[model samples]
Target: MNIEYITTEELSKRIRYDVRTIRERLKDSVLIEGIHYIRPFGGRKILYLWEPIERDMVLHSGHHTLAIPMANGGRMNG
Candidate 1:
């Protein structure tokens, strides 16, 4: 797949999510590694992959259960 890498601000505009919310809450919680985002060149800067995220957004847009892993090895559901 031809994936497009986007910055937090760009993603915010595309997804209508606040950049702060994405950075503070959604990052690592909903948007995960090797799936939603990546750190290119092993650097601190993060680049979000749009395709997977968009796919998941559409795929999970129904009344299905959603779960996300927490940093403390627990899970949160919605």
Candidate 2:
């Protein structure tokens, strides 16, 4: 796998997310350690792996509608 390490600024540009939001919210919530990002040599700086992030974003995106089951036993596609 050709893993590319990018800084917060670079990640922000690629994902169109604000640096502050990335640092404050997405860093630990959406972007997890060892999976989405890494702290090199146990350092404080965080470097994100672009491949996994992009892949998950596309996979989780609303590309197809799924049938959701309701409490009344009816299926609704949304």
Off by over 4 Å in 2: 64-78
| Residues 26-67, model 2: lDDT tens digits | 988989999999999999989999998998897787544587
Query: What is residue 9's positional error in candidate 2, in angstroms?
Result: 0.1
lDDT of 1: 0.91
Tell me how far the alpha carbon of residue 48 in candidate 2 is from the true structure, in angstroms, after superposition.
0.1
* C-alpha positional error of residue 13 in candidate 1 after TM-score superposition, expressed in Å: 0.1
When superposed on Cα atoms, how far off is each prediction in RMSD?
A: 9.6, 5.6
Candidate 2 residue 56 Cα shift, in angstroms, is 0.9
Best by TM-score: 2
Cα-based lDDT at residue 42, candidate 2: 100
Give the deviation of candidate 1 from the true structure as CA RMSD.
9.6
| Candidate 1 residue-wise lDDT, 1-78, digit = tens | 688999999999999999999999999999998899999999999999999999899888853557787899877895
* Backbone clashes in model 1: 0
